[model samples]
Target: MSLSPDVFTYVADLVQRRAGIQLDAGKEYLVEGRLQPLAKEAGHPRVDAYVRDLRVAERPADVQAVVEALTTNETSFFRDGTPFRLLTEHIVPALRGPNGSLPRLRVWSAACSTGQEPYSIAMTLADCVGPDTSVEIVASDLNTAVLERAAAGEYSRIETNRGLPSSMLVRYFDAEGTGWRVREQLRRQVTFLKHNLLEPPAFGGQFDVVFLRNVLIYFDLPVKRQVLEHVLAAMRPGGFLVLGAAETTIGLDDGWERVPLERGAVYRAVPRVPAWGLPTATSPVPVVLPAARGPLTGAVPRTAPPGVLPHARPAHVPAGVPAPVIRPITPAPVRGETR
Candidate 1:
């Protein structure tokens, strides 16, 4: 059954309040898909009905199930492929401590939906640094079910194939029936926990690199700022933050410096006031990028919108993809009087 407006609103509100994720309109398909199973199990004919019932007299367990259902994310090994590239090439090298030694590096994988992301990180780190480098990975998500699944470190045959290369597969995974389980040594490198980004974070010690990719787009601007604040507090000064290709800190938070790279966008945490997530005097000055292609549109009459950060634009435009052209229109020749 089609989701009604009231059902969507209630679900959206519940998710936003508890998880800081925004569910704007047009996501009825998503709401219906995730909640359909729950709705069926609850003996409701449709998700909208289940949600309506939830609004009237929701139990704590039901609420938890609803939020977890909606917030459960789809993730695979090395996910987008580029952020891990940035991590391997740039982030780790630059994070070396005094005397050029790899310190006990801590990397947090926030909102890590399942085991793949953190395992991917651990694999990359193992490949880059020798046995001497001390590495620790903390993978956390708000949803407990996914966290439990992630911590188990197992994958089906289909799950193993996605974005995971064969060489690493042979080295890292133990053969099981039609699938594989992550070996003990690799699993030991990561620790999974439950964390809400909206609250202050204390993860034992400051992290040197954080993979917060793709999770920010679900938040409204204020929640984005709040999460970034909490993330910054948990990171060491000059720590690297890898956002999803479509996500960024531009214009939302001034405490991040956009690291200019040939490919993929990553932010470096500038010195900031931990109390409020505001930048301190030592915060790096913003560097406005050159204007993007295409003629300006809309009443604003600007290359981009006002209040957009100087560096603001889609995180990356592919190397050879030509910039979009705003072709000028020439009026058709006047009918009978054509020259």
Candidate 2:
């Protein structure tokens, strides 16, 4: 049954209030489609009745479930290829500690729906760093349901086929019936937790890199600023922040400056200086990067390489291929430029 306007408004407001996600007027159809099964399982038999119960009873679990259903978890291995390449070639090399040794790096995959994003990060780092390097990846999502799946690090055949190269499949996964499980070695690098972006930072220490991509579009201006504030607080000085190609730090926050690499852009935080002329203890002068590509489209391009599909998987599968050594990805040279 279709949701009445009043019920839809009530439900939409509830989601915005609780989870900071904005559902527009036209999203009643989406609510109807996603919530009908939940309603039936909840024994309401109708979405309007379920929404009414949600309003009157104010059950926390049901509210969370609704928000989770509404939240888009659309992602794939290397969802955008440029970000991973930029990470390997530029960001990791640029990172250094006070003593000049490569510091133990901590990365946060905010809104990480499942294991793919974080695991992909680990795979990228593995290609660059020695096996014994100390790197930690914390993957968080508001949806506990997805967090559970992420912790397991298992994907069905269809999931494996989405942006997961056959080489990576053979190298990083163990065959389990019709599914593939992320090897324990790779899984150990990432930690999964349930987290809400609207809340204060609680996932432990400061991060060197925060992947806050493709999530801010779901929030209104106030919520977007609030989440960005929290994210800024969670990052160490001079740390890097990567947003979706469509998102930027303009207007919402001015502290981040753009780093334009050919693969994609990443942002680095500028340390705030005191009114006095003297430099603060921790604020390092920000490094300037080359001019960025023209304004980003905010949409993931459909024509990425074989393993990094944002929407769908390949129709056929190749089996038993050995994983190729992942080479460090560099930017394509300019036509008139000499290295």
Candidate 3:
């Protein structure tokens, strides 16, 4: 059944307020499609009836259920392949620099859906860092239901098949009944929590790298600005920000300095300096060797000129590979190489 105009408006406004997702005029089917199952489970014969009850009054839990229902959670392990590639070949090496001990990375997988993205990140890090990994990952999504699933670290056969390399799958996941489960070693590397992108990240400290892919396209200009601001505040100086292929910070925020990668580009934030040139009371810039200035290392101010990068850029991601079909870019400025 179709959603009544009143029901649609109320749900749309509720979702927008709670998650910053815009459910415009043409998304009635989408709203209905997502909420109908929830309606049935709630014992309402129709979406309209369910929303009517919600309008009269609904608990926080009920509101959350509705918001989660409307939020898009389409994700796959290494969905587009570019972000992970950048992470391994470009971002990781840049952070490691050409010397010193391996640095522990603090990565925030924002808007992580059902664990794939974060799990994929964990696997990638594990592969790069080897047996003695010291990476700390916090994977957050507004939808608690997905967070719960993510924490469990289980995936169905079909889910495992997508974008997951067979070698990594066998190496990282132990077959559990019908679906595969992330091995404890890899699963322990990531912590999942419920988070909202419009607000400050719940984690008090700054992050070395953040994965915020494919989420901003759902938000309007104002909300997008707000989200970027929040991301900027949470990122350490020179920390990389990964956005979806179609998304960008070009006109939205000047704080970010774009760094182009092989297939897609990543942005880095310019850390603010204290007025006295002394370290700020909060998140003081730490003095370190030049090797420590890459994307996922500890925070430090960039002293280089605006056009120059604080860290050395790689020659290219893969030195030599046949040109495959590059993902189409919307002139949104998301496509590029990382070397």
Candidate 4:
């Protein structure tokens, strides 16, 4: 049976209130498709009755489950090829630099579902950045269920085939029956956390790059702007911000400058001071040494000197890779609230 407009609206509002996600009027079929199974499992006579029970119940877990069930977790290894290429070729090398003095590199995969995104990054970094440089990757998602799968760092062979390069599969993963498990060495490089983009990220320091791809499309404009503001604030100057191919920061904020690379689009934080005002003095900058040589030995300093920029080598640009093309910023569309 079709969900009445009134029933759909109530369920939609409840989902939005709890998760800050928008369910459009046209998603009536989606509502019916996702909820009908639950109704049957609960032995409810109809969809309307199930929704009514949800409304009257004081416990919100059932509603939360419904929202999670309806959410789109469509993702795969390197879902978009360009951003990973950019990270491996330009971003990582640029941050690593010639001296290799920096001993740690930090990256965040916001809304990383089922661990594919972050694992893909780990593989890329392990391959291009080499095993010697210290790198730490943080993968977060609002959905605890997905986060748990991500933490496991295992994938079915069919699921692992999406967008994953054959060479990487051999190098970073070990076959387990019909599935693949990320090697312990590669798995150790990443940390999984439950984070809500609507709240402040619990990261200790600014990130060198943030992958907030594909998630903003689900939120209303105001939520998008707020989330972007928070993400930008958490990124270090010169750090890159990657969004989905269809998404752009045009007209959103002037703080970020569009940096077009051969693989795809990425954003960089505008320098705090104008180029002309950069400090010209040749004062010897103190460099801190790494405590020990480990997987990330050359990625960051063991201790940083005050006011010294964290050193990062430019990501390795593959031979024949095109140079980055800088583009002018476009204005973002005005935000609206949808109920």
Candidate 5:
């Protein structure tokens, strides 16, 4: 059943306004394809009639069903090897110390689908910080359906092979029939929660690293900036923000200083006050050794000088071979800002 252009526009506008998801003109097919099944399941005769019923329905469950169906949850294990490589080799070391005195290293996998991304991160952290390090992986998704699968930590063999290296795969996952299961220890390290990035981050305080990768492409410019701003606020100063290869913060917020790793890109927060100007009271006075400043002092700002966005230059690439691949693992809408 075909939906009138008028109905399509109405539904699309409602989705974009409420969910921050942009439905392009060509996505009419997607609306028809996804909603057709839902309409049938709901006992509606046709897509147009189903959409009409959805518009007048008091309960939001049907509306959410359409949104969830339309959402593209395509994700896989260890997607785009470069970022994970950077996370394990550089980002993790900088955030953590040798003794693991800090009880937690908080990492959020924003928009994590079916759990592959966070599990990949968990495997990397386990290897880098040692299995015993007290790291907390918070994986969240807008779709409750995917979150449940992620919490289960189960994966098909084909799904497991994507972006997953053979070596790390053997170390972190065990095979069960046609599926692979992430090790219980690695699985236990992560806590799966439901969250919507379009809403304010409800978890409070800053995180050491926030992974808001490919999900941004679904949003328009304003939503993207708003989401990035909120994600940045949740990230601690000097903490890492990883984006997808095709993505960049260049045109968006200036608060993030893009730090180019040997393999991939990471954005570090620009301190409100430069370290040289920080008051001793608010600083990590005891933690700063003369040697610690050596790295910061010599390091150039990742962003462009003065007015430029951080361009990918050869000089920014660290000298040395790339690190090994780790392994493939395997929210609410609020009208107003809710704390």
Candidate 6:
């Protein structure tokens, strides 16, 4: 059954207000498709009937169910290979504090869907950091349903097959009946929480690295600006922000300076310079080595300077290159599919 414009608009506004996801005019099909099952389960014979009930009164639990149904949770282990590559090879190394101190990294995986993204991050850090180093992963999603699944760290066969190598799969996960469960070691490394991106961050303190990828594309311009501003406030100076390859800070905010990395997208908080020609930051600028200061120092402009990104490369490359294709093997389980 088709979704009426009135119902669609109502659902769209509620979603935006609660989760910061924008559903444009043409997305009625997507909305109808996701909500129909929920409506049926709610004992409404038709989507419109369920929507009518919702319109007449706001039931907190029912509202949450709709938000969960509409929220997109498509994700795979190492969803985009390049981000992890850049994170381990380039960004992590740069985050090393001076005086030969071992760096402690606080990473926020915002809007983490079903835990794959954050677990993938934990695996990468486990591989990169030694006993001397420490990494804390904070993963959050707006949907409590997904957060529960994420905390459990169980994956169906299809889920494990997507973007997971046989080697790492065996190393990090134990087979559980039909699906696989993340090993206690890896699962313990990440702390999952329920958080809405539309609200201010409350993960205790600033993060050394923030993964807000693949989420901003769902938000309108104004909401995107507001979300980015909040993310900026939660970042430690000179910390890295990773966005989806399709997302950028251009026309959104100027507090971040794009940090060029091979085959990956990353942004660094712009360092503030004092009158003495010396550079200072809100937090200790971790990872900005002597050679890296020139690019990160001074008041960064809205646009990146030329010749600065001479070493930058594409996110994907042909065979003989190490980049792995991370797109899903099957359509991600549609958001509203019954568990």
Tell me the TM-score of each prediction against the true structure: 0.79, 0.80, 0.81, 0.77, 0.77, 0.81
Candidate 4, lDDT over the whole model = 0.76
Give the least accurate 10-residue stretch of model 5, judged by summed lDDT.
323-332
Q: lDDT by residue for model 2 over 259-291, one digit each (tens)? A: 876646588876555433223234444322111
Report residue 311 deviation for candidate 4 (angstroms): 29
Model 5, 187-289: lDDT tens digits are 9988898888898878874688988888888999999999988887777777889988778888898879889675466888765444443223343212222
lDDT of 1 by residue, 53-166 (tens): 888888888998999999858899988888888887888888876466885889999999877999999999989988888889999998888999899998998999999999
Query: What ranges in model 1 sit over 4 Å off?
Result: 273-339
Reference-based lDDT, each prediction: 0.82, 0.80, 0.82, 0.76, 0.76, 0.81
Better of 4 and 6 by TM-score: 6
Among residues 3 or more apart in sequence or in different chains, the pairs in candidate 3 whose N, CA or C atoms overlap within 3 Å are 261-336, 261-337, 261-338, 262-336, 262-337, 262-338, 315-339, 316-339
Supply every candidate's count of residue pairs whose N, Cα or C atoms clash at under 3 angstroms: 0, 2, 8, 30, 2, 1
- The parts of candidate 4 lying over 4 Å away from their true place are 98-101, 271-339
Question: Model 3, 72-170: lDDT tens per residue?
Answer: 999999989989988988788777744634567889999998999999999888877754447999999999999999999999999999999999899
Task: List where candidate 6 sits over 4 angstroms from the true fold.
Answer: 272-339
Task: Estimate the overall C-alpha local distance difference test score of candidate 6.
Answer: 0.81
Tell me the deviation in Å of residue 334 in model 1.
88
Q: How far out, in Å, is residue 38 in model 6? A: 1.1
Segments in model 3 whose C-alpha atoms lie over 4 Å from true places:
131-133, 273-283, 286-339
TM-score, prediction 2: 0.80
Positional deviation of residue 27's Cα in model 2 after best superposition, in angstroms: 0.8
